[model samples]
Target chain A: MEFFINRSYFLNKITNVSHAISPNSPNPSYSGILIFLHPDMIHLTAQDSTMAIVTEIHPGELNQLRIESTGHMIVDAKYLIEIIRHMGGKNIHVMTVGDNMIQVSDENSKFNLFTLELERFALPDIKRPENEIKISLKNIRTTVDQIAYATSEKDARTMLMGVNFRSDGKRIITAATDSYRMALNYIDGEFSQNFNVTVPVRALQEAARIFKNDDDIIQIFVNKRKIQFVSDRTLIQSTLYDGTFPDIAAVIPKNFKSMMELDASMIIPVIERGILFKDDGVAELRMNLSEKGIQIYSGASTIGNADQQVYEVFYQGEELRMAVNGEYLLQAIKALKTLGKVRIDFTGVITPFKVSDPENKDMTMLVVPMRSSY
Target chain B: MEFFINRSYFLNKITNVSHAISPNSPNPSYSGILIFLHPDMIHLTAQDSTMAIVTEIHPGELNQLRIESTGHMIVDAKYLIEIIRHMGGKNIHVMTVGDNMIQVSDENSKFNLFTLELERFALPDIKRPENEIKISLKNIRTTVDQIAYATSEKDARTMLMGVNFRSDGKRIITAATDSYRMALNYIDGEFSQNFNVTVPVRALQEAARIFKNDDDIIQIFVNKRKIQFVSDRTLIQSTLYDGTFPDIAAVIPKNFKSMMELDASMIIPVIERGILFKDDGVAELRMNLSEKGIQIYSGASTIGNADQQVYEVFYQGEELRMAVNGEYLLQAIKALKTLGKVRIDFTGVITPFKVSDPENKDMTMLVVPMRSSY
Candidate 1:
């Protein structure tokens, strides 16, 4: 495209879209960022088949723009980004000199890069989808933060790599699990249609980062194959996984024989101390409740052992003994927002237990106990 | 060993020595730091065969020490560093509990770790050589800063991976090269015996970091296989590379055909500007000197080019044209400590060139030119 703009303004716009460009894409054209120059603004688009990002830069007071011609071209994302960042100048002039080369220059430095054919680049069509849902930006970001980490990273189980979003008429629930532990976040919202969809955790993380500055509502368009999150100046589209998500709601335990309330920080250090030794894949938590307080002891035989931790808790049940993965317990403790106390439910030695912050009832974490061979 | 000391005090001492411990050592005990607690002070030592560091922590200020036990043990570096950092307490009590287990605890947390046998660790039997040389710490640190970056990192040529120290009757010169470029620094010092030795670059870096507090004088004990740098509280021992270092003095060009004097900052931006291009390994400098001022032009083919950077310079010869790697030129420019003009001497298009600040002759940089097919 034939355009002249400030170096930093153009650099920032290209960087935002460049995150979606992959160097080793099967389609050669997908390795470049599509640039469209109009009369008043320039648009940049980058996609790697799975995720796409589109950003528009409007000429402002600092970014004065002059458009001599309107054209479209795809330039290599990695080289172009590096060239612009290292080109030392405040104002840079960019123009399409010929059919294949783009010229970028300033007072002391200039760069001419070969451009790929625009027709070969895969720019996703942005027509309005049939199924559209509107949600609050804050709620989406918070829900993604809470559940995204629990999603399985391995591709052996395709469906487990995504977080499932289920919306009834009034409230929306988000759950993620790798078949080991599950994280659930519930938010209040209004939905015109009842729908359930699985969105990839990587895409959700990118959406959260792009939506950080946007305070307005985000409109989501979902079809059978793709989902698009659109704001005012930014649009992020991601492909949907073609697998059925496991029914994790049924796996969450609802009944407990005994429960205890203890400070989250107090229990976190105790678990960390205990993780030093036990090599059998299980960390035993022996809890003794007396009139004074609750004492939690965990030990590992092969590495060493740890003791000397006491936490104040409210418990009326008999002394309970359970063994679970220390990493799972640490994750559950970290998910609690408030540091006051965490209410942990114990269903038997083998059943799944739930951990939740006493002040907030909307979030719950469940961890399946490891079978102790000892 | 039994001791009660501040947690931060022990953590700092361990961290200083832990850099020398290598987890992939042939002997498993070498992966741990040796701890020797006597009645007066506790000494910690770690070695990876290439470099070794020893630090001592004395008793008294914070807590009363019960010297009921005196022994030596080797603890894993990674686990000990992590535990000491995460254990949140001012005073931590450490004692040898059983055969190979040590108990580390405070009021809130306790950790027991399995220690390796002290007999399995290889503590280098290093003694201070009879005939040794001593140099000011300030001079040694300055010499290291000047030449360490030019040391070759490739292990194929072991001798190039070290900085060669040449001491005559009155002066000590340090030089390093990676076959492409070389840096040499000459400093005035008193030596009892003239000798030349090569020390590993990594050991020099560690010595520089450890002696950052500017000790008065550092004693250097050099043997056939080892070199020891001794200070008041620290002893840094490193193995010497056996291969003979190349004679770098022969590569330095003693005479020049053309010379030019210009400000160091002027050439810095030009080199920075030339780095924007994908190709064009060497930045060409064409100087056209007439009755008017000098004009310097630098350009890259794939990237655009720049022209007409006029600077007032006194040229000693006819119009000169030369090209050098932009990175090498930038390095030479940065090594100039003074803010005034720098003198650059060129022999020919392919021969080596030298650059030095006009005020000081102690520091000089020699760069070999990259052959250009064109």
Candidate 2:
């Protein structure tokens, strides 16, 4: 097989598929990308048992192309991508040297690599599910960004590394928690079924990257053990997590005694300046709400103490004090950046506080407060 | 003692002296910046055993000041600088809280730190030498920038960690080498005496930073064991290196059979793009000069091979091939960034090659060629 492709164009196409290539996988075929050259098209495919990605190059993208025969070869993803990335000119000439070796070259550079036999490579089954849901890639990106960061990345409980997607026939709710804080979003759309599937956060992140435009339509196919996302002629299939997520109603705090409503812009900077000892291990800020205003205090072992008064806060009920991680609160606040005002509800010093953006009422952030020492 | 200074103004003044305050210094006193709150002014001082730096914030710079008593306190340099950097208001209040503690506060932030008493802090004895050389900081910076990077940073041969300074009552010759490559600069200027002193590369780099302007006149006082640089109301004293520098003439190649002159800008990019296998341990580029043009070749075990033609060279050399480290050549080219065209003189395959800019005749760089295996 022989074909010609633009260097940069080939690099972009290979980069997406190469993400699924785990270099140290026990299965040698999983460590490479399948380069399939057809008479009229060329594409690359890679898989890491649990997930698989495929990307194609259309007919008119390359400068020139000639295929001696339709064939496929598994080439090391890293070396192939690196060669094309650093190739001299725009056009690249790729050809099959032998049954187990391929040569890729340009005008002044050439690379030959031993490839795995085509029979040994396994591409994940990506047939459309019984009931596929049509969703905008943009909406998925927003929901993923809002909830994925709260997932437990290093937790040995593998299921916590994913975001729980629960649909009750009409509305779909997405949530993520690391046992410390929970971020939940109520997406305004209907899904196919009432399935509660825990999709890995990494898969959601990769899907977000694949779907560049917010309005682009993407087809999501779900099964008992796998989910496939198809968009713009590319397919990303990941395995479904095999554990159950905690009940959202039980995890979210409901009642609060004292509530403080403040301008979102005013509170962000106040927290940034007030929490001066951020470089130390865990960043904590104390919030004391009075009838007049709210007082924020933070101190570090060596870097002094800070006390800032924010008169913009509207307080109700008796005086209340709560201490929470400053960075987590900042992130939860930034997630609602488009909103004009933010409201924080505190029940007691030892209780979890709930934060909500007045403008975006569909989403709420629950922050677990640390035991106060102040 | 009490004083009020602008936050940004205080940050900049403290930044210079804080460099000498090595936080992990063996002596606790060296980790703090001594704040000498005089009746009319306040100055900050910091020192590691080998080096000391002092910077002044004069009386005119502050908005207001009321010095109740004249005393000194050694406050932690890092914490003090961090507090002033993130201070809320324009003016910061600095005062002595007690016998061994200091307080720095503003409208929204307050910092208190335990300090080393004035009696325990050991200040280096700084005095003007009998004879000192008056030189433009700009010229010294230029010379230091060109040669300092060539020295051995962690080599057991401590003298190689510094640049050699030699004078003949008229010209100061500076050179540095890491036993592989050598950088030499001959600066034409008058000096107080014909002395040879090896100044640590770190000291030269710090002095270059202290003297911001090239036209600023700096007095360099040299003694048997220490070198004192007084510039712009700041004094930086560093212990001079106590050993002999290798004879540069014996190290530089004296004979060559081939020479090539090329535009430095053209050569830099050609080398960068032609040798992309840089992530591997050692980068070797083979330069083959033919009657037509020069062809550069580079290859790695996994990352393929690269060959590019460079037609922008003026060559009268025979058919010769030499392998050299690409990064070393790139660094040498960068050192001559201001020059338009660069000339490289080569002797043989094993001999070192000398590179010089046609415009800047004062500096010369010699790069050792690696022995070829292919």
TM-score of each: 0.89, 0.90
Q: Give the top-scoring candidate (lDDT).
A: 2
- CA lDDT, every model vs. true structure: 0.75, 0.77
Note the DockQ of each predicted structure: 0.43, 0.37
Question: In CAPRI terms, where does candidate 1 land?
Answer: acceptable
lDDT of 2 at B272: 75
lDDT of 2 by residue, A1-374 (tens): 78876778678778888887666788877888988877777767899978889876776634344555677888878777766776667788888875666887766545566677667787667776665666678768977778787788778777788888878567778888887788888775546567778898777878898667888877888877888888877888889888888866456767788888888777887777665565357778887789789778777765456667777678887797778888888888877765477888887887777888877777888888888676
Q: Give per-model CA RMSD.
A: 3.7, 3.2
lDDT by residue (A1-374, candidate 1, tens digit) is: 57778888788778878877766888878988898988778888999978889978787787776776788888888778877887667878888877788877776445677777777885687665667777778777876767777788896878788888777566778888887788887776555777778888767777776765546688888877778888868888888877777666657778787788888877676667666555567666654444356655566565566665564667655555566777877877786766788988878777888989889888889888777652
lDDT of 1 by residue, B71-173 (tens): 8898888778777787777878889888998888988677888898788887766677655777778877876777777788786888888888877567788
Report the error of model 1 at residue B5, Å: 2.6
Give me the TM-scores of chain B across the candidates. 0.88, 0.92
Segments of candidate 1 deviating more than 4 angstroms: A155-157, A188-190, A212-214, A243-254, A276-302, A312-316, A337-340, B62-66, B132-140, B155-157, B187-191, B243-255, B259-273, B276-318, B335-343
In terms of lDDT, the poorest run of 10 residues in model 2 chain A is A59-68
| TM-score winner | 2
